[model samples]
Target: MKDAWKRWGAEDERGALNLIGPDEVRRAVSLVKSGEVVSLAQPLSSKTPGPKHRCGLQHFMNRDGGDYAAGGRRPGGFQFSEDSVVMPLHIGTHIDALCHAWYDDELYNGFAGNSIRSTSGASRLGVDKMPPIVTRAVLLDFVQLRGKPLAADYSIGRADLLEAAAAADVQIGRGDAVLIRTGWLESQTGVTDVSFDIEPGIDVEAALWLAERDVALIGADNYAIEVLPFPAGKVFPVHQRLIRDYGVPLLEGLSLEEIASRKRSTFLLMASALPIVGATGSPLAPTAVL
Candidate 1:
């Protein structure tokens, strides 16, 4: 872990994202063939399930001709409508900022966790520091590789990632965005359990492997990018290793069924966390261009 922190630099905050340069963007652009785009975000609504501590979206609309009307009538009695939404930053498909996780008392880049927070939010390593991500995205469909939807207790390790990549005939490269599809999200319809229900995700060993490869970001269709009902005595070890130690961001609650349906191994991915200053995370709307 110490070596992981030192590999980037003492002053760096963007971490693995630094691997994506002009060349990477150009390479990503070259992967687009069909010009078809698929959104990777789940629809946000009042019924949307989220973490226990986070509330789902609250949408308010001002319709035409009501007491809270959007505006006055136009030339031919035309009016406008307006809407607003409020929800936790991590509710939907989202990116975790460098400040989103910490080990003991320190955050990524060695920022003291307690000292960096106030009523407003984190004073350093906020989501606003995250740059727009444009890179090659590789989909590793574990459901297809394993011939079944992984069980809640299943832990995907380095071997699973390697085998999936090999099976897809795609090479995971530095600065690339990797989307792991466990089919968990797709299986959640009509589920009575809360959003925090057990789900399959990468294990700590696989996280370290990704960190070594310099992946810019890793996302999944599960609620969290790491297996839930965490191994006894281990509290989000994978998250600590990836975010706190390696400075790599996590994208959770992604919608990958559409992208996976295409059966393409590589595509152009565009995703950017909302630049909310001092925020620990931000809602994201990632897209895959095929």
Candidate 2:
């Protein structure tokens, strides 16, 4: 696959997102019919650890005194509660930055991968550089296509994606956000033994297919958007090609069960990554409006 670095120019960092312009946003807005909204994020819980070890969320609460209202007119008049949370940026449903993966030594736009790291985060292609994504979104429900949940190690290829799209009667348009439903998230009862070790996802061929279509982003219900333990002798080849070569961001751990159950193939997707400077990814609460 040819790299898109020269196509987007040297200083470009946003990658395929650059395809989403005012016309695309307007087209997305035109797709809204009922104004119904569905959240695409899994709820954060302290009891359940994330897919990765040591990435669980921790919560703390601070409460005002019950009877001692020193800065209030009455003892019970001034009561407030505050809370804080700590977790990895990629703990929940999140989008990976262009700097998140690379081939050997170079990142997207030919930046030195090793030289971009710092105590704060990556100096180039960080998550903060990604703008809010508002565009036409299409759902390719693989579970429905297979008539059952795919096997944990199933690797979806280019042909599978095309067949699913045709079956759903959805058009894969340029600058669109494509979400794939494997039914993996719906079958899970808890985070433990969720099969993070292996799960169904797109293969390198599918990655190249999406790149050819000029997709802005790709998301899936599974933890990683691409198959784990990849094809023989390949190490995260999908990630390397999509993020480092095509500059397409990947969305993982999405909550697509509700939308999948509804059987809607097209919707308007809106997700804005937090401007956390230097971070490789950002936890997001993406919403789909139907």
- Model 2 clash pairs are none
The Cα local distance difference test for each model comes to: 0.86, 0.86
User: Could you give candidate 1's per-residue lDDT for residues 76-191 as a string of tens digits?
Assistant: 76556778888899887889998988888888878788846577787778888899999999899988887878897688999989999999998788889999999888888787
Which predicted model would earn the best lDDT? 2
Clashes of each: 0, 0
- Summarize candidate 2's per-residue lDDT along 52-74 as a digit string, tens digits: 56568888765545434555334
Model 2 CA deviation exceeding 4 Å by range: 64-76
| Model 2 global lDDT (CA atoms, 0 to 1) | 0.86
